[model samples]
Target: MLLFSPVLSLLALSVVGQQFTNPVLWEDLADTDVIRVNDTYYLTSSTMHYSPGAPILRSYDLVNWEYISHAVPRLDWGSKYDLTGGQRAYVEGIWASTFNYRKSSRTYYWLGCIRGSNTQIYTAPAAEGPWSRKGTISNCYYDAGLLVDPDTDIMYVAYGNTQLSVAQLSSDGLSQARTQNVFNSPSNIGTLEGSRFYKRNGNYYIFVTKPANGQYVLKASSPWGPYTSKQLLFNIQTPIAGGGIPHQGGLVETQNGVWYYMAFVDSYPGGRIPVLAPITWDSDGFPVIQTVNGGWGASYPYPLPKRVLESPVGTDTFNSTSLSHHWEWNHNPEISKFSVGAGLKLETVTVTNDLYVARNTVSRRILGPASTATIVLDYSGMKQGDRAGLALLRDQSAWIGIKNDSGTFRVIMVNGVAMNSNWSTRSTGSEVSATTVTGGKIWLRASADIRPGSGRQGRFSYSTDGKTFTTFGNALVMNNDWHFFMGYRFAVFNYATTSLGGEVIVEEFTLTAA
Candidate 1:
C-alpha cells in the first residue's frame, strides 16, 4: 500500500481537473469544418496558396488536433497569378469547405470553393485517402454549402454570386440537376452566402451570413425559397460582439440530439483567420450565437467525439526515408531540393526570381502566440560570396537573413530593393567575427512574440555549443498585415554563388513555444 500526503493528493486532483478545461485558442487553424466518421473526427480547412490546398486534420476532441494529410496536392488554379496583388492568395485556396459523410455510400464528400466561378467537389472512400476531383459546380460561386435529403436522396448546393441561389445535384453527387434562384436582398443582408439547410419539426431552416454584417436564419416550408428572415443570430452593436463580420459555418446535431452551429470570425488584425463559436436555439426555434468582446465567439466545451493526434515537436531529423507532415511548403515544394541520409542536406536550387514565386520554400507556421525555433547546420567549406544561414522569410519584400560567408557572419534585412544593416537600421551590411563550430554543428535560433496592435517581432541568436547563445543585434519585425498571411517561419537557405560544389547540411531543427 502507498501512503499519500495532502500536497500530493491536491496536485493529483489539479492534474485531473486540468483535463476538463478546454483550450481558448486554436493556433494555425483557418476556415475550419469538421465531421465524424465512426469514432474518429475529421476536419478540413482552406489551404489557399499554401502547397497543400485542403488541410485534413484529425482529433479525438475538438481541442487537440494534428495535421494528418492534405486533401489536394496543389491548388487547381495557377499560383501567384490567381492572387490579388499584396494579398495572401497563397494561403487562401479552398476557402470555407463542407465535409459530409455518406453512410449509404460509405464515402466522404468534400465540397469547397475556388477563387472565382464555381465550387469544386472531391470524394474519397475513407477519411484518410486518395481524394479525386469530381468537377466544378455551375458558375463561379464562393463559400458553397451542401445538404442531402435523406427521404429523396437529392443533393442541393447553396451559393452566392451577386445573390444567393440553390441548385440540385445528380444522384451521384456530381453536376447540377436543377437550379433555382433563392433570395436577393439589396441592403442590410445583401449578397448573402454560406447557406446551410436543415429540417426540424416540419420546417426548413437555411442559415446564411452576409459579409461585414451578421448572420441571418431564414425559414421556409419547401427547400426552395419564399423564405422569411428572422432576427440576426449575432448583433455586432452589442457590448460583447463577435469580431470581423459574421461568416459561414455549419448547423449540426450531435449524436446526443443537441444542436450547435460552427462558424468563423476575423478576430486578428486581418479579418481572414477563422474562430469557432457555440450556438443555441431560443424557445422560438431561432439560433443565437454567444459573442465575446463584441468580436468572435470562443469555442464551447461540447462533449463531442474525436480522434486526436498530438504531434511531437522537433522531429524533422531528416533521418527517415520520408518527410514528416509537420513540414509545409510555401507553394509547391521542389521535391528534388532535399535529400535525407546521415543528415538532411538541402541543395541550392533556382527559386523564383520574383518574390511571389518563392512559395516553393518549405516552412511551418509558428503554432503558439509566441515561440522559439532553432536549427543546427554546418556551413563550413564555403567561400566569401557563398552564403548560407537560417532565414526568417515572409515575402520577397519583407524578410531578414543571417548569412555566413567564409569566416564572418552578416545580418541583412530585405525590404523591396533595400537590404539594411542591423546596427544602423539603414541599407547596409557589417561583418562580424565568425563563431567557431565543432563537429560541423552551428546552432541558430529565432524567438518571435505576437503582440496585440504591435504585431510579431523577435530576435535571432547564434551558438556554437548549443548551450550559450549570443543575441545578434536588432530585432526583426514582421509586417502586421492580418488580411494577408501572418506567421513566424524557420528555413535553411543556400544562395547563388560563383563557387561550385558548396552545400549546406542541416543536422536538426526544433520549434518550441515560449
Candidate 2:
C-alpha cells in the first residue's frame, strides 16, 4: 500500500516522474499573460510605474524561464512617470494586459490600460523588441485580455470588473468598434477582473478573477451578450507556503494544444508573484486547474520536457552600452544622467529630501522566500549631500549607502523612509546606524526576508573590501501590503540633498536566493 497526502501546496514532492516546484521563479512577476511562438514560450507581466514596462521572459519549457527583453521601452504616458516636479506615478501606469501574436500582420501585440486613462496598445515584430505604441482604446479597459479571430481578423478585448464588458476593436485593431456588457458577477461575488479572452471549439470564453482570490469563466456562442458564468478555481491553496490564494492570470496553449495557466499569489513584501499549473478543458468546455488530490500542488510534473536553465537572477557586469532587461528604472530615467560602460555611472539628478522623488534609480526584483543583493560602489566621485548605495525600495523602504554629510563620508543604514499622503509624497527616513570612512570604493548589501507574514526584514551590511562584510543597522521590517501594488526591489540609487552633479559608479551587482 502507498501512503499519500492530498494538500501538497507546500512540500516539493515527486509523484511518479520528474517534477518542478511552483511559484515558478520565486520572483515578483504579477498579472502575467503568456503565449507561444514556434517552440518558445513568451510571457509579459505588470510592472506598474517601473520604466521599461512589461518585462518579457522566454521559456523552452514552461517550468524554466529567462529574462529576454521588456515590451515597453519606456513608460512615456505622462510627465509624472518621469518624476517631473516631484510628481510620481506609483501604483499607476501599466496594469494587467494581454500578449498576442497576429499571424496576418506578423506582429506581436501588447494591450493594457495606462492609469485610469484609455487602454494603450503596443506592438512589435519580435519578442526581444523595439516595441512601439500603436494607439489606445477610447475608454479605459481595466485588467483586459485580447482575442483576435484568425479567420476574420476581428479583435475583441474583454475588460471591466464585477460588471464585465467586452469591447470590439476595429478591424485594424487600432480602435474600439463597439462595447457591450457581457457578464456580471452575482452581488455576492463582489469584484471580478483579470479577464483572459479566448475561443475554442466555436465557443468564446472569458476567464476572470475575483478579488484577493477566486476564478471563474464565462462562455458564449457569440462575441457579445448572453454569456453564462461558472466558477473555476476558488479555494486553491497557494503553492508558496503560507502565501495567499492564487488568481488573476492568463492561459496558454502549447504547440500541440496542451494547456497551462500562469497566475500570481499575493506573497508580499515581495508583492504578487507568478505560479504555473497544468490545466485541461472538460466535456462542458470549461477549464479546470489540474492538481494533486483536488488542490494546487507545490510541485508538479513538467508539462513539457524539462531543461536545466539559468534563472533571471545573476551578476550584471556593466560592460554593455545598455542595461540588461533584468533592470528597470524606478521611473523614466533622465538619459543624460546615467550611462553604462566600464561601470554604471549614475549622476545625482534630483535635489530631494526623499528617495521617492529621486530620479534615475535603476532596480531589479528581490527574489523570495529570501534573497541577497550586493553592489560594489566606486564612491571616488561622491559629493557633499550625495547619498548613493543599495536599497530595498518600496513605499516603506530601507538602504545601506554612503551619505556625504558636510564633506565627511558616512557609511550608514537608514530605515522607515516611507511614502505618505500620496504615492508622490515621502518623508526623509532617519539614519539608524553610521560609520565614518574616507571613502574610495565600498560594498553594500541588503539581504531580504520576504516570506509570508509581517516579520519580513531586510538586513543591511557593508565592507571596505568585497569580502569581509560588517552589519550596518537594525534589520528593517519591510512593508508587506497590497497598497504598494509592486514588490520591494533592490535599487541602485544616487541623489543629492543639495545641488545635483555629484555621481557614483556601480562597478558590479549580483543577486542570489535559496
Number of the top-ranking candidate, with lDDT as the measure:
2
What would you estimate as the lDDT of candidate 1? 0.57
Give the residue spans of candidate 2 off by over 4 A.
1-16, 424-426
Structural RMSD, model 1: 6.8
Q: lDDT, candidate 2, residue 443?
A: 88
Which segments of model 1 are wrong by more than 4 Å? 1-25, 79-92, 196-204, 235-247, 267-274, 290-308, 311-314, 340-344, 351-356, 380-440, 485-503
**For model 1, what is the alpha-carbon lDDT of residue 51?**
61
Question: Worst ten-residue run, lDDT, model 1?
Answer: 1-10
lDDT of 1 by residue, 44-139 (tens): 665556665676777544445666677775565653422223333544566666767777887677787777756778888877767778777756
lDDT of 2 by residue, 1-514 (tens): 1112222233233335888788787888888988888878988999999989999998877877878788888887789999997588888888897878888888888988887678888898998888999987769988899898755788898988888999988877888899999887888778899998988878899989987779988999888958888888887877788789989888888887889988889988988888889899888999989987777888888777765454555677687878888889998999999988778999999997788888999998988888998898998798889999998899888889998988889899888888874775566789899999875899899899888778888898998988999998898888877787898999999999888779899988878776
State TM-scores per candidate.
0.78, 0.95
State the displacement of the C-alpha of residue 68, model 1, in Å, after optimal TM-score superposition.
1.3
